[model samples]
Target: MSGNIRSSLRGQRGMSYWSLIFYISGFALIILFASKLAPGYVDAMHVENGLKDLAEKGNIRDMNRGEIVRDLQTYFMLNNVRGEPTKSVQVIRGAEGMLVSIDYELRQPLIHNIDVVMKFNKQLNTAKPELCCEPLVDLEQYRKRD
Candidate 1:
C-alpha cells in the first residue's frame, strides 16, 4: 500500500511536469507566429492606405508635395503600431530634372528585436511602375521612417 501511494504521487508529479512543458511550448509557438506575421500585416496596411490616399488625392500633378507627405504620415500612424517614423522626411526634389525621391523607415517586430526600413518613391512614371509595391522590399524601406 505504501509503495502504491509513492508511485501514484510520482505519476502526478510527472504529469504536472509534462503539463508545464506543453504550456510553454504552446506559448513559444504563439510568440513565433506573432513575430513573423505582425510585420507583414502592419506593412500591408500601410501600403493599402498609401494607395488609397494617393488615389483619393488624385492627379499627382496637382497634389501638394507637403500634403502628400502629411497624408503618408497619417496613413502610417493609422496602420502601423509596432514600427513608426522617427526622422524628418528627406524629400529629394528635381535637380537638373532628377526625379524626386522619398525615404522612410519603420521599426518592426522580431524575435531578436530586429528592425525593418520602409521606403516609397514618386518618380517619373518610368516603366509604368506597379500600382503598389510588395510588403517586404521597398515597403520595408518606406515603413515608419526613423
Candidate 2:
C-alpha cells in the first residue's frame, strides 16, 4: 500500500511553472482588455441615461428639434461625455409622437493597432439597432458652439 501510494504521488505532479505563467498571462490580458473597454461602455451608459432623463421630463414633444439638441448638448457637456452630441442626436417627429435617437459609436485604442468600438443607439421609442459609421444627424452649423 505504501509503495502504491508513493508511485501515485510521483505521477501526480503539481502545476508546472509554464502552465502557471500561461494562466497568469491570460488573466493579465483579460484585465487589460477590461480596463480598455470600460470607459467606452461607461460613457455610453451616461449618454443613455441622459436621454432617458430627458424623455421622462414630459416636455420633449413641445420642444423643437434644435431645442432638443441644445438640451442634450448641455447634458453631454455637464456629464463630460466624449461623443459628439451634434452628430449623434436625431429628432424624428412622427404622427404618433416624437422619436429621439442618440446614435453614436465610441472607439478606444487597446493594444497597438487594435481598438474597441462600442456603438450605442438609444431612442425615446425603443431604439432599433442600425449600422454604425454613418451620420445619423447632421447639425454642423450648430457646430458653432453657444
Candidate 3:
C-alpha cells in the first residue's frame, strides 16, 4: 500500500510540473501574439499626417489661422475615442516658414492606465517667410483676453 501511495504521489508531481509548464507557455504565447497585434504608432501617424497636410496647405500664407486650427481639430476628432479634441494643433508663423506643432496622447494597447504622448512639427510655406511665428488662437492669448 505504501509503495502504491508513493507511486501516486510521484504521478501527481509530474502532472503538476507539466501543468505549470503549460500555463507559462500559454502566457508567453499570449504576450507574443498581443505584441504583434498592438499598434505603437497609431496616434503618431495621425498627428504627423494632419500636420503635414496643414503644412502643405500653407497655414501662414494660404489658410487663415482659425480655419487651420478648426480643420486640424476636426481631423483629430475623427480618431479620438472620447469623441473630443484631446490634442493641441497650433500653426505658428515662423521666421523661415509656418511651424505646425501637434500634441496628443495615444492610448496603449492591452495596458491599463497608460498612454503615449506624441508631438511633432513641420515647416510650411518657406516661399513667404515671416519675422516670427504667431500663434493661432493660442491658449495664453485666450486666457489673457478672458
Scored by lDDT, the top model is 2
Ranking by TM-score: 2, 3, 1
126 Cα displacement, candidate 2 (Å): 10
- Evaluate model 1: give its TM-score: 0.43
* Estimated TM-score for each candidate: 0.43, 0.73, 0.45
Listed per candidate, the RMSD to the true structure in angstroms reads 8.1, 6.5, 8.8
User: Which one wins by lDDT: 2 or 3?
Assistant: 2
On a 0 to 100 scale, what is the lDDT of residue 111 in model 2? Answer: 88
lDDT of candidate 2 over 64-140, digit per residue (tens): 88988788888888888765544777777667566677766777788899988777766664232222222344444
lDDT of each: 0.49, 0.70, 0.52
Q: Give the per-residue lDDT digits (tens) of candidate 3, residues 1-146.
A: 99999998888775577889999999997996557434435555565565556555543366667877777787777866232223455555655545554434444434455444432333233343331222232345533765
Worst 10 contiguous positions by lDDT, candidate 3: 128-137
Global lDDT for candidate 1?
Answer: 0.49
Instruction: Give the lDDT of residue 32 in candidate 3.
Output: 62
